[model samples]
Target: MITEDNDPRKGKRPDPRLGSGEAPDLGGFTMEDGTVTFDWTQTRVRLARLADAGPVELGRRRRFFVARDDLAGVKLEFVPPLVQAIPSTCQSLDEYLNWLPEGLGRHLIVLIQAGASALGLWEEDRLVAHKAIKKYVVRGHGKAQPTYLRSKGKSRYGSRLRLRNARSLLVETSEKIHEWRNESGPFSRVFYSCPVRIWSGFLDGKPAPPLSKEDLVKIPLDVARPCFDELLRVRRRSLVGRVRTLGDEER
Candidate 1:
């Protein structure tokens, strides 16, 4: 359970709808604080109780519930840990809730930007291995200068160099990821955020990382510079579940 002392929304004013006595139309409700989070253990317990007491609506990334009596119109939305993917076999809400993992298991995080990338292998909550790579793939202006850009002399030469370096970075990153997977057995999930422009290059490397389409879960939060510490921070945030209150209209 999240306490008021450490709640992400502690300093913000409580939503007025939460205090209003009128029955909220499903569409009339507003988002409350999302800082109210639950760990996997707490999440499973809470979901189980809700399933027993009321009906649940499931979505790809979230779940919804409404209670009876005084809580009839208040909707509760549950967000699961972003690092994990819900199994496709759970066709019913009960089955999905029952299948929730007791805790986060083995996973890999891959963060990539224009000229830098970071990788980390984690078991439960501990980061066992990590690697960070940097290369001169982007020009000083912060954009990737295309090798095909029609330019003269030095400008053209620089673009070609940057393009070559970019390819090298992709190959090296893919090799490292494959090596880690070999050494660590297998990762249950691979959470990654790579730019669209570089995604194809990474996947088409001479020896691409052995990542399955189903197991490739994208990191949902905005990340800063890729580094070892940033990987740890992302892992912590991924374990936290965000809550939003919906109105009857949301049903």
Candidate 2:
């Protein structure tokens, strides 16, 4: 329910250094042209101070806003109460387009989470192609056990299984990245955001890594949900390791 009218710039000066990136000239902190901007550093600190601070609720998304003050300082605000701020997940190319800023053209956006991931290609704010994948779960439920009798076997096994799956998923994700480049058309730029650990272990690796230090954009995990959901809608097509492009019949 937050709106532009609540922008702090009208009344007070924002923190000048709030969102300056490693290289100030980069557009990461720019708020020009109605572009919705997010600053993970200041946002995280302020979020931790909120009384309701904790993990985001199930099936919801969170957003942090950064506004420019009249003096050029930066103002930061998040959707209040964080728990009920789910803006609804993007389900179609049009829906996803609505969430992005105007003037984006031929850019690749990839998002990865612990259990799911998504990749999409957009040109002039129109979705050209996309791919999404959902990791399968083998076990269903678990029962409480006494701490003295607790076993690490099940946890270790699950970790190993997930690691194996993650390795395979990494390869598939890399393939899609290449396809977006060589097959779809030459994307002007690529923006991929994910957790540091996930990015390092899988994406920042040898023989066709998905991202480089210069291109990775660090973002909150909550922001990753919609990307995951956007891809989830196309999981069926991606299962066959093919890129889903415009006008293609649904499988």
Candidate 3:
């Protein structure tokens, strides 16, 4: 059994093949019942991390992973780009999306700033992993805050950036740095276009209860809709009020 300190991919369900893909598999797991379970692999672990943070059990062995990455593993930061714009080397938004992995951020940065970058884990080279990471606004509706306040909003709504529902793994491992580098040009401008910091979390590659489609569909929208609706109302109300007040407030 590989310890967490030594093997970065330790406990990850290894595929019965090479990273390039081949056979005999690299990792396996053994159950308490002494039963043998095969066909389990690491690629699954990568996909699992994207959704949930936990160790996955591969084939049959004492195989398992520590659930959830430790705090030190996650790092978060913002970086603006050297150029005023991002060059996707492609034409349309769909072409860009099609060119990369899921959960990307071009549309997001375009709305927030001229350019930005995001760094996280990759499953078979996708922006997927154990600890989630991404960018968002300080308020539920604006760009990331210059500074986080005490979050005076109702306790029901804790922090605004968190509300965007983006999280990043902070672990400064080779993998973490690798992901950041891919997004460096657009993720930030802090380090000559490198990331100043990034949100990170330990990824033990352990498997946990899988998130069901029902759970994914209902939970977030239910939690976020209230505040989103309120922010929209606040903006509209402020806009209309500005029209009425400009004529008289000057006096």
Best by TM-score: 1
lDDT of 1: 0.65
Q: What is the lDDT, from 0 to 100, of the residue 215 in candidate 2? A: 34
Backbone clashes under 3 angstroms, per model: 6, 2, 54
**Residue lDDT tens for model 1, 27-63:** 1112244434554446666666666656666664333
User: What does candidate 2's lDDT look like per residue over 7-57, in tens digits?
Assistant: 444233222213222322111222334333332223333334321332222
Question: Lowest-scoring 10 consecutive residues by lDDT in candidate 2?
Answer: 236-245
Better of 2 and 3 by TM-score: 2
TM-scores, all models, native as reference: 0.77, 0.44, 0.18
Candidate RMSDs in Å, in order, are 9.3, 18.4, 24.0
Candidate numbers, best lDDT first, in rank order: 1, 2, 3
Q: Report the lDDT of model 3 for residue 122.
A: 28
Candidate 3 Cα outliers beyond 4 Å, as residue runs: 1-133, 141-146, 150-175, 178-251
The regions of model 1 sitting more than 4 angstroms off are: 1-35, 60-71, 146-155
lDDT of 3 by residue, 66-150 (tens): 2223333421111111111112343532332243332222211100111122322223312232221334434555533332433
Q: Candidate 3 overall Cα lDDT vs. reference?
A: 0.25
